[model samples]
Target: MCQLLGMNCNTPTDILFSFEGFHRRGGLTDHHADGWGIAFFEGRGCRLFLDDKPSADSPVAALVRAYPIQSENVIAHIRKATVGPVGLANTHPFIREMWGQYWIFAHNGDLKDYHPAPGQYFRPVGSTDSEAAFCAIMENLRQRWDAPPPLHELWEEVQSLTESIRAHGIFNFMLSNGEFLFAHCSTHLHYIVRKAPFTTAHLLDEDVTVDFANVTKPDDRVAVIATQPLTDNEHWTRIEPQQLILFKDGQPLYCS
Candidate 1:
């Protein structure tokens, strides 16, 4: 299985603190070390980075840790390589264009013997079930509507499609389209929301601590989602099995 990390905020925010701990799982603190990647959404564009090396030691990962790239939505993944070879194309937080927006997706679990039909427009460049699933979702959306539907309606279709896919096996995943982030929990998935009166928090994998209040405005809100809790102090809400949640402006807008 892989590990997933996601961030959604009302204002553009850097993921340095959380990613510091999450990236450790790619080889140092945990064992999902086959490859890793991340995507940060800035307006309608996305900055994507991928590497076939362990994130804990990759120079690209080091750059990401030091850089303070701000984004409204972000998704990251550290892979353990159950279904595909250890390579760049197999690394996730995969990206594709849909409805004039970049849709980012990352999966954390395996789907046994799952093989979907070829997609009309979107297709996987990698030989992983996660990538196949992503293409299938995009194909479904492309076939369901002539254009992008409203957010709520779009979520409904996403949920239905996700449910169908989960029937094959474990399907925990995170998805985002710059505007909103959608997370589905098939197994382990947790999240924490930080807002007014933010407090200091320490990382579980490192000795780093940051008092968010010192760097953020009173109105800023941030929601962070991961395969497991990243901090040692703050409480993280564990998403229920089969649950799908939509987040915007650092708050959950819909859950089912």
Candidate 2:
């Protein structure tokens, strides 16, 4: 299994503090260490970085740790390689284009003996079931509608596809198109939101601490979702299995 990290904010925000701890799970503090990748959505464009090397020590990962790339939506993954060969080609956090927007996806669980129907619209560039699953969803979305559907409509369709895939095994995943961030939990998943009257938080994997009040505006709000809680002091909410959440502007959009 892999680990996933996602951030959705009302305004552009850097994920440096959170990523610093999360990336260590790729090799140092934990043992996910196969390959890693991250994508940050800035306006209509996205900045992405990937490496086959262990994220804890990859030179590219070092550079990412040095820079504070700001974005409104971001998704990242650290892989453990259950189905595919450990190489750059099989990395998670795969990207594709849809509805004239870039879509990023990252999975955190493995499916058992999964093989989706052959698709005429989208295909996977890698051999992992994770990639195949992503393609399946994208293909379905493309075939179901010519343009991006309404958020609630899209959510229902995605929720169905997500459940179908989860039938084979775990289907925890995060997806974003620079507009909405969708997270579906089939196994373990947790999230926390920070807003005005922010407090200090200490990373569970590191001794580092950050006081949000010192750096963020009063109106700033951020929602972070992960396979596990990244900070020990935060009140992280565990997302129930089979639940799908649609997030925007740093909060979950509840659909009635």
lDDT (tens digit, per residue) of candidate 2 on 1-256:
6899999999999999999899999899888779899999999999889999989989988988899998999999999999889987789788999889999999988899899877888888889999999999999999999998888888889988887898988889999999889998988989999999999999999999999999899999999999999999889999999898988999999521
Q: For candidate 2, what's the RMSD?
A: 1.1
Q: For model 1, how does the per-residue alpha-carbon lDDT over 1-256 read when each residue is reduced to its tens digit?
A: 6899999999999999999999999998988779899999999889999998999999999999999999999999999999889898898989999878889999989898889989889989999999999999999998888788988999899999999999999999999999999999999999999999899999999999999989999999999999999999999999999999999999999999
Report residue 147 deviation for candidate 2 (angstroms). Answer: 0.8
Number of colliding residue pairs in model 2: 0
lDDT of each: 0.94, 0.91
TM-score of each: 0.98, 0.97
**lDDT winner:** 1
Model number with the top TM-score: 1
- For candidate 1, the per-residue lDDT at 250 reads 98
